[model samples]
Target: MAKDELGYDRIVERQLRGVAREVLLQVGSKGLPGDHHFYITFRTDYPGVSIGPTLKAQFPKEITIVLQHQFWGLEVTDEAFAVTLSFSGKHERLHVPFDALVSFTDPSVKFGLQFELKNQQVELQPADKPAPGAAKDEAPTALPKKSETKPAETNGGGDAKPATIIALDNFRKKH
Candidate 1:
């Protein structure tokens, strides 16, 4: 197979993430059917993400918000989406671009989608806490440097793993 010279993975990731946005807009415009619900996790610091100060204080890094029963004014546009949700008896509107989403899951049918943020957008942070004996000045290991080689194929493989599609019946049976 000839080596690729283009960044296809990033393009595919962008497309897949757009699918999530379209699906959310569909469900939000038309009410959710049956027990289907969404748990969306996104980066709080992503550009175009607007949340109330209280919510920002509570979820300084990332937040997983549920879209089930309590939301209103759902609007979707070419670049971003805005929704009004109530918190602590006060309603707050949040505007999030499709690029900000990190993970989305519809647990009713075990369906999920994950995304990789652009290199410039991803935060460099340690996962595990330092050990008791670890030096304070020690830095967390950096991610492996990405190669400049092009992708071998447009699609990774003809038999690439399928995106998770939740069976409607599975959600129906749950409730």
Candidate 2:
């Protein structure tokens, strides 16, 4: 195999991360548009990740967060993004560097991206399907897209209501 002297893989990774950063900046300022939301997955143990000890323990390897209704303090920078999320009624703040990201997805539009880390270097892959070893029970059930989510109308089917909020597992492509 020829040596990758120019390091195109690293360049591609940086570019992909930039895309995520730009998307985050847009959402941070304007918030999600229409039925759009985000499913952000990252390596919990990666350098520059900050989460409460409980969350660290629970998701020692990785965790995916949903940014729909319940998230707050969405601040994005060139390096990382920070936000607060509710986990089982307790609010927790998270700091995730773009380099630590495993994937990013907007299932409403059927768009996604996957990242690979090999020896601390980065590579990007299409999120049309999750990369190998990406499957795990990260959430209670598989995530829901806007159309796929339909909360039973407790108000006796009065009017159609959009899905309030859901996270990583809800973002999964239904098999």
Go through the candidates in order and give each one's C-alpha lDDT: 0.62, 0.67
Angstrom error of the Cα, residue 142, model 2: value is 9.6
| lDDT per residue (tens digit) for residues 5-79 in model 1 | 676666677677777788778977787888887766677788889988867766666666667777788888867
| Tens-digit per-residue lDDT, 1-175, candidate 2 | 6666887667777777787899989989998899777788777778999999977766666666778777789999998999987766667789998988876776565566666653564322222332223223212122233345344443325554443332333433354
- The residue pairs found clashing in candidate 2 are 143-169, 143-170, 144-170
Q: Clashing residue pairs in candidate 1, if any? A: 4-150
- The lDDT, on a scale of 0 to 1, for candidate 1 is 0.62
lDDT of 1 at 51: 89
Q: After aligning candidate 2 to the native by TM-score, how far in Å is the CA of 75 from where it should be?
A: 0.7
Steric overlap count per candidate: 1, 3
Off by over 4 Å in 1: 1-4, 121-175
Model 2 TM-score on a 0 to 1 scale? 0.68
